[model samples]
Target: MRALTVTVRDASTGPVVEIAGDLDYETAPRLRQAVEGLALEPGTLLVLDLARLELCDSSGITAFIVARNRAIAAQAEVALTAVPAHTARVLRVVGLDQIFNLYPDADSAALPSAVQPPPTANNR
Candidate 1:
């Protein structure tokens, strides 16, 4: 099994978490902890860069859900970038593809449109 590595960096939009190695039952908590520790603000986007992710099982998927839930609780948004083909397939199979905003790369996902703006009187 590959050693799981979860690293976080600040981005203009929000935090960009780069998850490498295996994201399975063993290392899922690490991700949970990393996400829980983030100070997410409303109208910001939390981007998960999965370009180096080698594996992702059900537990890993659950971790992603947990991150999403946390983001929602903060009134922020979460997105997945550079998702591996296999993991992407599993996410699609479970219908999470509709839940997360998928981006081709971290740069694109961190754009202003990544997280929806607060409803304004004109938009309402």
Candidate 2:
């Protein structure tokens, strides 16, 4: 069995997790751990770049869902980018395509600028 490797990189959107190799029962936990470890801020958007992902199974799909939930819990958003055709089909079949924000690339999913108004509780 080929070893699975997930590389993480910081992007303007948020943390970009690049997954490669086979994502199965044995390697899904690592992917979940990597996503959970990131302390994302509210409104931040996490982009999962799956262009390099070679394979995936039910466990792998579950890991992706876990990552999405984690991001939402932190008040951040999560997007799937460059998902392989096979995986995309699986997601569609499972109705996850509607649940996750899908992007063609990382650049397309870049986070928008913050638009919160300045605090005015104690202005002089």
Best by lDDT: 1
Q: What is the lDDT of residue 4 in candidate 1?
A: 98
lDDT of each: 0.88, 0.81
Candidate 1 TM-score versus the reference:
0.91
Candidate 2 regions off by >4 Å? 111-124
Writing each residue's lDDT as its tens digit, candidate 2 over 49-101 gives 88888989999999999999998899988888888999999998887887787
The TM-scores, one per candidate, come to 0.91, 0.86
> Which residue pairs come into collision in candidate 1?
none
